[model samples]
Target chain A: MSETPIAAPDPPPGLSELFLAFASMSLAGFGGVLPWARRAVVEQRKWLTAEQFNEAFSFSQLLPGPNIVNFSVIFGSRLRGPAGAAVALAGLLGPPLVIVTIFAMLYTRYGDIPWLQGVLSGLAAAAAGLIIATTAKMAKPLFEKALATRSLDAAPLVALAVFFAIGILRWPLPYVLAVAAPVSIALAWFRR
Target chain B: MKGDGDILLTLAGHFALLSLFAIGGANAAVPEMHRVAVELRHWMTDRQFADLFAIAQVSPGPNVIIVTLIGYQAAGLAGALVATLAMCGPTCVFAFYMGRTWERFREARWRNAIQSGLVPISIGLIAASALILALAADRNWVAGAVTFATAAFGYWTRLNPLWMFTAAGLIGLAGYI
Candidate 1:
């Protein structure tokens, strides 16, 4: 694997530009925003390389709140500190907030229409499927890496334990993470 | 029902705490959100909660916007704004500071170990989220079929997910699913 040069030396984005970029991303994102975010940040803006984007996104996933929201904060702050984060977040969320609110109001008024209910039910099911697909795609690589490196992989096992504890057993998430995270980290340390 | 101030305060406080536990994004907190909104507070019915989640999913931007809808249902526009900010604020601050210092530990062994460990945990969280949402959405066999088909298609195909969403909606509209 070729090493990415440290700091590819891209020009820093202005606060307003950051705002516009995120605002446009939010506006265009219909089903989800992550794909659009990748297109803009990695392909269009050239702000982060594909590998860097993956690393940043993985790190963002470890943080609390929405992955994309955390991503905007980390990306913007990397460029221009706290103020940049604020602006980028505002841009990302502001337009969608207004649009979604309007949609909510419309649904409140007319949601009882039978066809709309049918449509919603279908969409909801599809949404659940999308989540499942995402989980499968993410897990595949981890499982592969685990088997590739060692005959026994603690990472995939810990993950399955977490899935069972939370998904089937219905344990409280905070407590599960509190135990699982530290244990898994230690396991990785030992394996390393 | 509670007064607006009480409701807003409750909404803000609850969502703020929820935001911190959202390790795999807002969806990870769905069961907890369901507990607080449906069972504890009676803010909305189970069906209503489900509908709001669907709306949030269909609309643009992040999944966290469901909190805005929940807050709006509970306490109007102010509640929506408060819930949105409360959900995003604390974590944003944390990410901002972490981003500044993260580069310093790029090669740290502990950091690598933590990252390796956390990947599976996060994947597990996402799987848990899918299970929760599937149980919530699949109210009947037909809906269950839609969900199963969609999952299969999404996993095996390279098609954009929006098409699945659209096709499912149309199927529902046609009263087939």
Candidate 2:
């Protein structure tokens, strides 16, 4: 949608600005950085529009490893080559490593306390809910797109097959994916 | 017991492979991580694995931090460093090259097809991860209720998730859940 012919108002960000932006987002990201990253990149900095953000994020998701980390690298690389990618990655991961280490130390020392254990259990339950919600949010758009496009009937089928294999049957991931991914891709290619 | 170096090497090798397979993001690999860490290797109990995942979620930065914490549990600071690098390093290089190609082929029909096919699979994997996590975390009716309630709120509202976590934590601190 943002593939506009008009010129952008601002120039691209410098390496320092990119680093600081990622660092701030990392600190602010409590549950997941995807939302925070969206705000910082699309709204605050105007580095990418909403459409561009979605494109980059979707592409990042398609690659292996952490989606946001991959997004950081690709976005930074796009902006300033390898150096930008390095700086942005450092900003994203550096602070949290230190903070999490401190938390690890504290948990190790006092983790056996009954009340603390209760708290951790509660947090785990909530985290489960959060993931479900994230899945729902992600699915809504895809389903809508599928219906509108008059294709993607196989998409939901593939999704259900994967869910059954991994979630219910407890099959190994690589094997199920090895079979499922190719079939899904070929289906899409033929349908398209 | 394995030596410290052996443990670190195992962690490095396992996470490197996991990184490549984490197509839907780090959360997609949660079940495998749980299987390896708790069931296969016995690095820690199921409870500890759940707790570390929760801690990573509550803390800032990417969800990938869970790998770092798991590595630390298995070994030490050195383990954390090695695991984090192994998990992220190859992926970074892959993304660097793939992203460049993707931009070049922004309008390629094949790229569109691949993306469409993969999106649903990623969604399915994430749902599986959620199911496993719920099974691990919900030890009682109250905890299960908390999971249901949080899912409702998260889906219906735009409230920051930290608030929900805080409410649940307060419930726990009160010895309720």
TM-score of each model, in listed order: 0.90, 0.92
lDDT of each: 0.83, 0.86
Number of clashes in every candidate structure? 0, 0
Model 1 iRMS: 2.1
Query: Model 2 over residues A1-192: C-alpha lDDT tens digits?
Result: 234321133566788998999999999998779999999988998888888888888889889899999999999887888998999999999999989888887878888899999899989889999999988997888677779988747787788889889888888777888898889888888873
lDDT per residue as tens, model 2, B42-85: 98888888889999999998999998888888887888888898
Off by over 4 Å in 2: A1-12, A140-152
- Which of the CAPRI classes, incorrect, acceptable, medium or high, describes model 2? medium
List the DockQ of the predictions in order: 0.68, 0.70
Pairs with backbone N, CA or C atoms under 3 Å apart (clashes), candidate 2: none
